[model samples]
Target: MQTEEGMVQDMKVLVVDDEKLVRRGLISMMPWDRYGMKVIAEAMNGTKALECMAAEPADIVFTDLMMPEMSGFELMEQLKLQYPRTAVVVLSCHEEFAFAQQAIRRGAIDYVVKNDLETDVMDEVLERIAASVRSRADNRPEQQEASLHPLFYEGESPVRLHGIPGTEAQLMPHGDSAQQASAEVCQALWQGMRWLYEDESFEQLLTLTAELRLPQSQLKDMVFPVLLKSGYLLLSLEHSLRWISRLEQSRRWEEWREVLQEERSYLRNLLFREKHAAEVVQGILQAVVYMHGKEELDFSQNEVADVANMSRTYFSQSFKGVTGKVFQDYVKELRLYKARQLLLQSSKPIYSIAQQVGFKDEKYFSKMFQQQYGMLPSAYRNQNPLRVE
Candidate 1:
């Protein structure tokens, strides 16, 4: 987004999102090179984004709303004051339309729904956004409240599943009131939620719930409660339409059970075996996913935790519980793993490889490499050199 003189760089973009996948997806959604657009940088949160912009200002920023330490709103507010020329575009979930509206009022030039993005939809959005940037129609006020239409959505609204995060649970088919769970039954059901809220496996949770043998409608109602209590509500609601389809099609209890069984591995990966209960697990989930997506896991757990809006102690504990490994250990392992891959597959120098994977000291990287593989990086490359034809 660096300007040659005073004119803005057309479509020179920076993406900010806690989730690395979403950030990468937005960047790669179109072939920027072909369109004279460049992805300036990718930042995990607004704070890092500001630093990136200060070093090399981007013409436009595509940021998400619910980040940890620095939310998109805060970032935009800063942009309005510090970098007024830089166009701000919000990337949001459908349910966050109200927040996006507020962002528009503040100073965002435009917004796009993350949940509804398709290649074609993204093309139209990018064109519109780029045009606005080129024309310098900066942060124009909306004539009316921005409303979401089906054209901007790919599936049924998540609200249909449980009406946003903190509301009362809804029954699928209206179970009999008399048959509704009693205090004791509800308490017992709540007790069963341990299989979910705690870091228990999906199979274990399903096994416990299956034993209860409640009516299908009542049982269906239990899903949201379990997810709500587990801090998996937002994650689940993000994929609600998919699960709701299964719930609707499965007439029998067994069918419903089968649907859940299919999702076991995915759900299992999402849960930690020793859950540190908090209202929001998105921070933990985002941090883990963000780390995995990177070739160089350079940042500290504290940095990631801070960006995710969790206490360092809590983030460390929750990360260990969810991933079954300490954060530093996990990062070390990932770094070494990538270094090993690069050593074997890439012709880059050993020191270069080490630095690329985030080790500033080549000797330290070599020591870790030798410790991990029983040989130094150079030795490993010699043993397993890859020749590209």
Candidate 2:
């Protein structure tokens, strides 16, 4: 059923067949609601289907073999490469076994003969396809859930262990033993990320965890995805770190060590369930650090907008939305915060601290600090007693 807001609880389907009568019958007769499928659009041929795909995203395609402009084979190839998320099902006559075989080989999920097109068959096909699509919905971390089905057999790496019992290894988690093993595997993944980026001691953990009886190869396979995902995460994180390097010079590397420690859980979660969100937040933090480190760079909202890869206007809005402060205000407050810390902690002159926080003149920095904190830099240092670290 479709809601008042036009949100239909149906798997979006694109039906493409050259024969008008067949296409119409399939679209009109199929119990789409029952199978949780919605015939969002119909195409007379493969060419038309491709055109529609660009405008309307479909969860699956039910296409005919013989078409005028483009054949089912061609369409299936395009769909497999381009819209991999959208599954394909070939629709040809029963005698066209060779065509159906070819379609299946080309990555069509299933094939249905035109003469043998029973409602039950279509219902079953749609149900299965809907299940596949729904499984990928962004609810939790994606990396942790590997399908138990045979389809993933080709994609998975061979399982091996250093001190395990069985020669033939299975990747599927079974009981409490398997659950504990999987947790250990996840911890290894976290360790590997730290090893690669933060230079954390990971080899010791790997050598010590051999008592888990996991196949060495299986553990390697599990660790592989985390390594690959962390590469991208590291690139985005490093991009932000570049900006931070300019903000403060004292124990700069140590500062990164501290910040990465704080954000490790967020990064690991990104490596597992929410990679893109992690990248965005990493970039944001990097921007903050960069602005602080480069206390005298004269950076502007537009520059930051460009760095964040957002439109100047949208960047401003997102900056406020995420950080709860306008971009300029956030930058100023950040700089002032750094300036205040320097004032109390270090014997660095007020002018030097002001310059270090990105202000050209000490007077400007002092005035901004006073307006923000209701006190001059010297006065703040005098009133607020520094806590010994």
Candidate 3:
């Protein structure tokens, strides 16, 4: 597809799978050029995939969920840390569908079930990825500038900065030369902190700080407060506050620098962990929604795990951790909840309603309903008869 400059940008793709036949089949079947893409490389597993990426970076990676040396999930995490711009799509078998969903939540753009792999599905996924890449490329400058704003102090209008465009001209901060210099240093340090949170390289942080003309002598003192205010430490900010005070009082600039670097590394790791946790929570919530909205109560933990792209064991544990119920119990509760709602709202007979909600035997359904609600389905329906208006 053509970029905004009207230049064609071929999407580079890397196909990864442990199975040789599957990899060969995908490479032969997919019309890469038709989708404005080219398979620049292929790998048998995640370890090989990383090696391939280092040699020839790809815009998109299609990887199998399970592979030797490194699993798809581990590769995804590594990619998120190293190549946040590249998009990932997972391929997995029907049994591992839940694991695929987890991959998507962890930053994979999409997933394809090997059992249901189709040309149309691949086409749709490719189209979506292309659109996303194009959109990001179009908005890159604006996004970069927006990300810079957090570095500014409160009420320090970012629009007025000469480096940033689109505002009425305003004079630079007017005051003592030293005071202005100090402010500039603080801003530089804040910008450095911003980069740290974004998982940027230390070299980029150094370049940005240098560009701001920050004095090296002031680096230690200037950076301390910015780290404290970053809010990344959350519950432990006070503890870090004490440590910062101690470092400053000790007047150990070299040690202070070391501590600051450590903190930045810590913050970067913390941000990634938090982001991963949020994704898992979101994936599980979506699974719960899917469970509640289904027409058939035939859903299994395996199916739910597939939807979340998590292993059944992991999904079960995570489901309990997030929702305070085991996977089976949660699904059973939802099915019964729906049964209750239908019992109270509709005139459908108990047997039909039971079957609709996935209960095969009416007697067993009645027993379950009675056990849950302390009354038979018919009795409950009679007591709360629907009002026809």
Candidate 4:
């Protein structure tokens, strides 16, 4: 243990990876002092890691799942029987998430994806693991809960959360998590943005998104901000916001993956629609993002024209040229789409649902709803009740 000014900061870390660069990156990249941890040892493989542990015990072990001498899984099994006090954190590739899950079942405390470890992102992860380790050492489970999932308001009452700090979430982020996303992840996200102005193929974007994809809990910090940068504002897109909200509420990483798969499919359809190369389409994409944010479909063609900084006639022609849809019709269809969601999720009277979804008259809403969804709102709701979860 190390102490200065009568404070104890004594968590020791052991880093193990087969690749020398990976070992060096994990060791060099960590801000161990901030987390009250010190790197006591480094190893090229699991066998050497165990030797280091036997000589000088560590509080945490950051290990890669695959190695030349002994695999991470085998090392974990040995650690379980040998050093139960030490916690394991799997350092992994995106494709190795399945292995990480198995490691978790075998007693890994957490995981940090190697490919996604931007400096700040890694720091956030370190903070979480540190808090967890601190909590375990102190024998304070309450501190663990308070540190990780800090209190958020629910209605009027302040639900007790042991002794939560000012910050929220178990993950480290004093601010927006998105801003804290790693450079690689952010670059992967911008690959999609590049599609707006470049001739980037839909398949290319798909490959990027697939590689960038991580469990929402793992990715919570970065997706929104990068999406905003790419002009896919969730705030204005009510349905998309709902999708994210539901994803956040999901209980399992598997659920997050499922939701993400659907989101990617939606992006494929929207971003690649009648793909064009001219810069005017970039403006059209921006204008579409800006106006789509308003769920009521309240903005006028002139407003969008102004937003696009083009004459009404030209913007109209270009918007269709880019989207392959008339502006008014697009807005109408989007509003109807939102209405369909409200129908299944809420039991509001058909007229009320119509008004909330931007219909001046219930009859007109029903007409549009039928045209878009093939049924009246109430009938649709009857046919498809609110999903159980």
TM-score of each: 0.35, 0.36, 0.39, 0.38
- What is the lDDT for 258 in model 3? 56
When sorted by TM-score, best at the front, the candidate numbers are: 3, 4, 2, 1
**Poorest 10 consecutive residues by lDDT, candidate 2:** 242-251
- Candidate 3 residue 189 Cα shift, in angstroms, is 40
Q: Model 1, range 108-167, lDDT digits (tens) per residue? A: 656566877877666666666665566453322232124221221222123221123553
Error of 3 at 26 (Å): 0.9
Which segments of candidate 4 are over 4 A away from where they belong? 1-7, 140-389
The candidate scoring highest on TM-score is: 3
The lDDT of model 4 is: 0.62
Cα lDDT for residue 189, model 4?
Answer: 48
**Candidate 3 lDDT, tens digit per residue, 115-146?**
56587766755665566556545534335442
The C-alpha lDDT values of all candidates are 0.61, 0.57, 0.61, 0.62
lDDT of 3 at 303: 91
Candidate 1 ranges beyond 4 A from true positions: 1-10, 137-389
- C-alpha displacement of 337 in model 3, angstroms? 19
| Candidate closer to the true structure by TM-score (higher is better), 1 or 2 | 2
* Better lDDT candidate (1, 3): 3
Report the Cα RMSD per candidate.
Answer: 18.3, 23.5, 21.3, 19.6
